[model samples]
Target: METVMNRIVSPQAWKDLADRLGVDEACLKAVAEVESSGGGFMRPPSQLPKVLFEGHVFHRQTQGRFDASHPELSYPHWDRSKYSGSVAGEWKRLDAACALDRGAAFASASWGAFQIMGFNFAMCGFDDIEAFVAAHKQSAEAQLAAFSSFIRRPGLLDALRNKDWKGFAAAYNGLGFAKNSYDTKLATAYLRFGGRSP
Candidate 1:
């Protein structure tokens, strides 16, 4: 699979995503910029999608699959505080999570430029989690396809199309979206990408 980091966002990719989501090109471009710096990658070298592993989610997803004696397979000893804002730290935690269960591990982390959770594979038009990961490894085009599908499934496309950053962020970025200022940042990015200021 090609590394997502080096993939370029062609004009047609934006146009396609906008068309699929029934939104303006600028809206798609702004989200792309804010989510993955317009390229769907974290830092260089790894070229993997930026991911934050939710240990709680991992435990919930993998519960009852393994015995307590298998400490590595259990989440009880996992220290969420050990993982911070760095991608490297997140990767380490992700590796440990994968050891417990690959499906649950992948489902616990958000993927690609859109940062959609793996648990949302079905909502994102993927047949399953494995399929979602395969698409993510393909290219930015695939990632945008997943993003568009995710927004449509949750009926969040309207918020984006109307430039309702707060509504969009609330639905897309979760309730704590304000703490990250995702709404404001997206608004700023929209203006930068030629969208009308909101």
Candidate 2:
């Protein structure tokens, strides 16, 4: 449903960002690949940037006020079943949550390729969710830049550079990371991207 999804980042941009992040280009590529299948938007027709709504996050953002009335969109705990299981479906969830609480809704979802949470706008160098989402709509380069800034804020860059897949996954993906095998997937993708073992 989005009209602005014409984003194509060049290989040079990736390399340059990697250089600035002090990590191999392949390392960055691997995270991108594993994060959103190497693309920042869904397929045609609804090229909205990729996102995953977190009901638990919404609950926290709104202080659990809507948890009982809108358990589907706001829950006290993380529940995988709450997911719509597709890029478009996530937007639907976000839209519904937005109707209840716009700011909380925006802050509850992870946005773009790196899947950075909207609550992390400050960490990603944005003053607010509107600016964060605007950057996501601008270009994939903005998304990549946000990812770079995000990792550095939490000091995940060293974990990524050193190939500490487990540590990186645990920190970046949260508690359910191991359940999804994110560490192994990241390692496999990193190696596939020609990242040397560290």
Candidate 3:
């Protein structure tokens, strides 16, 4: 898999995503900027996307497959509270989680600038987890494609197209959208990018 350590989308890529989503390019740009600071990579030198691995999700995904006898190969035995919430921590946890179970490991972490959960592979139009990871390794355009797939699955595209920031953010960011002010932030970003704000 090719590691994408830099910004993957060009202006054209954003336009393509907008066209596919049937919304203004600026709205998509706002999402990209707010979700991933305009790209997926966390910073220079790292080819991987910023990720946050949820140990609870890993345990849930692994369930009966976890080998209690060999705690190293089991998600249930893994310490969920040990993460530092940094890039280094993400890599560390990912490496350890992969050692336990590849499928569960990948599914436990949110990927790319959009922070889409790995478990949502099917929702993002992927046939399986491997395909999703492959897409992540491909390019930013691929990442955006996944994002588009995600929003479309939940009918969030209509919200975006209509400039309904609260609706989009509520669905996209979850019920706790107000905690992060995602709706306001997205609206601000949209206006800054020359789009009408809701």
Candidate 4:
């Protein structure tokens, strides 16, 4: 028998977040579509939340101690080559990082729908990285709550409200946003959802 994937974000939750953020519902939906459209979890027995562990974060979290001994799990810079590629593969990387340093491991992964990095647990109003991860694993509602808290930072909320795709993508996705075309994709997704940010 296959274990079911847990998905529990409601339509109202999205609407509330959009309204609370002062952006159009379509703006928020476009973000969700671009970030994690397929829902948040790996199917089956493990049922782990979808994550992309950043080796650079692990390196920073651990202060570069594992750089030599475990270069794959910890690196001084963002190196896309270190990724394992699949959800299951990412879990394996997370597990390996956990073995070396649990806190750093959790801090290194980006979790759930918005791909909120675990290091932002405090910003998202979680007491700890584990709590953040637990909430993300529990349901999409929890993920949205984190996203709502996260986007409220200084310029980020305005980026969404004003439909400043490039600004939002840069702030949210890092300086590397353009490399992935995150801005254009967000614009396309927003338009696909019927435009209008306010």
Candidate 5:
């Protein structure tokens, strides 16, 4: 099935991330399929509080999937209303984030496509949010590298390996939006992508 994600052709980004992380192409592609919906990663350009709030919403959804005691969250909560509200709130902040350009202090702070913190951005050697977005659109490699690092940590891959595209998408996007029969969409996308039966 060819999804908006599968058809995303950020080759430069993919290669940059591959070179840095040494992740296999398939793995990178898979992660990309999850993050950004194969679209250019766009971070909510809001300040720390807003971004943290957004993360909190996503985190809540992520955490709600587990059995409370599960070591790591492997799925999204099934509560449709909860996550839908969260997405609406988050997109508002994201829109605010993007419109920032010498407005409020938090507004100018720079969260890019990957929701990268400014501290991490500095640590990673990026100049600013604009720089990050430009780079992400031009080359997804950095995004891929960062995602590879997040997913490659010991138990993470194991948790993700057993997940189907539906589960995976829920984990990547918030659960509410992800649950709307996305498996069917992914199936169509997979067939279009020439995916074999798993």
Candidate 6:
């Protein structure tokens, strides 16, 4: 069987990063395991792909072209710039893709192992996947920052600080129906990581 330690890219590196982030090492490691599976191109499918493909997903809306059929808020995945198009076709294609692109069965554009959604990259600071990955690879510090953004950016720390690992995990995973199922595993991992008695 594979050991949990084997999954982690750099444990000491993550420890140092945890020091900088002001969170406990055990907590941070748990968060990392739950968030990015020990870092380096390792994220769950839904979250990461959407972050990575957000640009292409949004481009279907055409920022300056003229088209028909696209409407603001017409589709769940519609770009915020839906109204920026000169015509409706830009909006139409975006709408179609939104309707058809359910759960990444077709797009197949997952870039980073973390599978950060494409839409969030620009607003999150990184310009592209290559830059984000190259800078973060084998570097626990960078991965820590990235995971911090992924978790805390959505108010995850508020939940985590309250011993709400499930809530934090759910938030990190974007699941509205998160439960406390993973709490035991997380707690066990914490004790082990913290040099505490189990």
Candidate ranking under lDDT, highest first, comes to 2, 4, 3, 1, 6, 5
What residue pairs clash in candidate 2, if any at all?
Answer: none
Taken over the whole model, the C-alpha lDDT of each candidate is: 0.77, 0.86, 0.78, 0.85, 0.41, 0.45
Task: State TM-scores per candidate.
Answer: 0.84, 0.93, 0.82, 0.92, 0.40, 0.47
Clashes, model 1: 0
* Number of colliding residue pairs in model 2: 0
| Residue 7 displacement (Å), model 6 | 10
* lDDT tens readout by residue for model 6, 173-196: 556434445655566666666735
Query: Compared with the true structure, what per-residue lDDT tens digits does model 5 show for residues 2-121?
Result: 233422456676566556655434444544343334433343331122132232233343443333443121123333332224433644544543343212212222232333433244
Tell me how many clashing residue pairs each candidate has.
0, 0, 1, 0, 14, 24
Q: Give the C-alpha miss distance for residue 30 in model 5, angstroms.
A: 5.7
Strongest candidate by TM-score: 2
Lowest lDDT 10-residue stretch of candidate 5 = 101-110
Runs of candidate 1 exceeding 4 Å displacement:
1-6, 42-44, 64-82
lDDT of 1: 0.77
Q: Pick the lDDT winner.
A: 2
**lDDT by residue for model 3 (6-93), tens:** 3567777778778877889988888878876776766666667777776767778888465464443344544645566587678787
lDDT of 1 at 52: 72
lDDT of 5: 0.41
Over 142-190, each residue of candidate 1 has an lDDT whose tens digit, in order, gives 8888887788844488888888889999998788899889999998998
Q: Please provide, for model 2 over 28-68, each residue's C-alpha lDDT reduced to its tens digit, 9 standing for 90 to 100.
A: 88888898988888776654789899999999999999988
* Model 4 lDDT-worst window of ten: 1-10
Mark the 10 consecutive residues where model 1 has the least summed lDDT.
69-78
